[model samples]
Target: MTRPVVATIAALFKRGHVLLVRRANPPDAGRWGFPGGKVDLGESLEDAAVRELAEETGIQATAKQVFTAVDAFDHDESGVLRHHYVLVAVLCSWVSGKPLAGDDALEARWFPIEQLGSADLALSLDVEKVAKLGAQIHSNRAFELGF
Candidate 1:
């Protein structure tokens, strides 16, 4: 039987903004979302998140924690499940590099938290909510550590 694919989405927060990528492939093509993809067979979630962030956005980041998980189910018009993904959201701290769209992304850049669900931008399902939570979590952590 087929199983839900496990993916890792990096919530790499930097300077009060979060990194996002405009997807170049389907499931959610053309929608802006956190950088991520299917996890490799032998890869850990943290590693996959960091790797995907780099692959899609050319941004180096360190995965600090697993913040949350989201279930994404794509159904065809006939109501058949086409894709089911368990997306693990990882909180990451920026290490280096600038946003350069690559891999499965058409564009990569940072968006301020306020702009996440703006009317002008097309965002993947639940992306804005997840991104906002990530920003909040990271901000809380930073404040706790006196950063």
Candidate 2:
């Protein structure tokens, strides 16, 4: 079986809040995660990230830089190697338009930085780590520029 290459974009909003979406489909239905989807044909990773973010959440953003990459593989109960993804997460700041849940996302909300570690958060460890890294980058930039 051929493995899937997926690219994901995570939006880190102001006030240390990250956007989390509830998936509307299977593989991880009803679970909360960063707003993103699979990369489309002939699309660059950065473009894919921008597209997925707009599709999953009604927010437009520019993918500034890649903050993290994660390789994940999983099998089903039937021992089928069902899911695999090379998730490329990019750091993005909101550019235009207020966000609303859209496409594969059942819902969307701003999750505070502290809330990420709570048991209620269903995202993977890598997701949280990348978000923290993004936040750190933002913080550093702010400090340097005296924002």
Candidate 3:
């Protein structure tokens, strides 16, 4: 029996920049995206996001809220779906430490969110859209709380 894979992604934003990592694994190898990985058994979504972020990038972060979720599917040449993942994007704030590529990441760096459209970034899946949405959500929350 095939089951949908659950994964988590962290959108770490600070000063108009978002932390991105180049994936070192398959299904989007070498593409830039958030630092995240599969949700371990008996782990909460937020916990998974935090753990994945720390595992992939040496940056310590605290997950605030879920920004969005996306469905990613890979198909074989015969149109058979090989893999599917339900990726939950969590908006997080940096708590401490600097980014260093580790685990499933090839490289890690911060990208200006405002320049996403014109930037020469090879983003994976719906990363650009998720980052934009996360920015909007963060902005709205800050405004609502008068921060």
TM-score of each: 0.95, 0.87, 0.92
Candidate 3 RMSD computed on C-alpha atoms after optimal superposition onto the true structure: 1.6
Which 10-residue span in candidate 2 carries the lowest summed lDDT?
5-14
Ranking by TM-score: 1, 3, 2
- For every candidate in turn, the CA RMSD to the true structure comes to 1.1, 1.9, 1.6
Model 2 alpha-carbon drift over 4 Å, by segment:
none
Point out the higher-scoring one by TM-score: 1 or 3: 1
The weakest ten consecutive residues by lDDT in model 3 span 114-123
Worst 10 residues of 1 by lDDT: 109-118
lDDT of 2 by residue, 38-139 (tens): 778888778888888888887888877777787766568787877788788877778876668889888888888778878867875466777777788877
Segments of candidate 1 deviating more than 4 angstroms: none
lDDT of 1 by residue, 71-143 (tens): 9888888989999999999999998999999999999988998998689989999898998899899999999
Q: What's the residue-level lDDT of 105 in candidate 2?
A: 89
| TM-score, prediction 2 | 0.87
Report every candidate's CA lDDT.
0.92, 0.76, 0.88
Regions of model 3 farther than 4 Å from truth: 77-79, 144-147
- Candidate 1: Cα lDDT at 35: 94
Q: How much is the lDDT of residue 89 in candidate 3? A: 92
Clashing pairs in 2: none
